[model samples]
Target: MSQTNNRDGSNKRSRILSSDVYRQRENQSSTNVAQTQSGLIIDNETALSSEIIKEQLNSVDDIITQAIIEVPTKHLLYVKELGDNLFVSLSTKII
Candidate 1:
């Protein structure tokens, strides 16, 4: 690998290792993917009807379900959940 030295005698890597965070570090650019989004929260009273979630639950069932509805990306996707409780919204714009 070649190294370039600056006028002040500092050096940097010729090629940077690209990952989720450092991929755009060259332009000092920032990305929104690393940021966590605040999603909608609802309860029993506010729960809407859906064929995707076809099950009855009590208060503590902590049900989490989703369907592959059409997104702007033209591909289908669903929510990613930590368990039966927490859910992460999935969308193409999240990038």
Candidate 2:
């Protein structure tokens, strides 16, 4: 099966294949094969850029220092509690 969409002012087609068909076709075409093998097609450059963004977001020491430097001491408690809850929720996964 295939689906078409317009992205960035250009038309693109996404092809979907079942697992057995995918394995049979894997070595025949390299253009989109790796992506299908991994279950989804994501541009490599976009993935690398987002990884950099994620590293910055998870920098806890910088976040804490900035909060203490800019926010009132009384508000620090609220920030801490929110951070703790956010951490717990992010680390837990639904099955």
Residues 1-95, model 2: lDDT tens digits: 13333452243222323555676676555643256655776443424467788988888785576333564577887887787887676667868
Q: Report the Cα lDDT for residue 79, model 2.
A: 82
Stretches of candidate 1 off by over 4 Å are 1-15, 18-57, 61-95
Off by over 4 Å in 2: 1-72, 90-95
lDDT of 2 at 20: 51
- Model 1 Cα lDDT, one tens digit per residue, 1-95: 23434522442233323343355542343332232225423232444466534544434346565645554342322232334334444443443
Give, for candidate 1, the lowest lDDT window spanning 10 residues: 73-82
**Whole-model Cα lDDT of every candidate shown, in order:** 0.38, 0.59
Top-lDDT structure, candidate number: 2
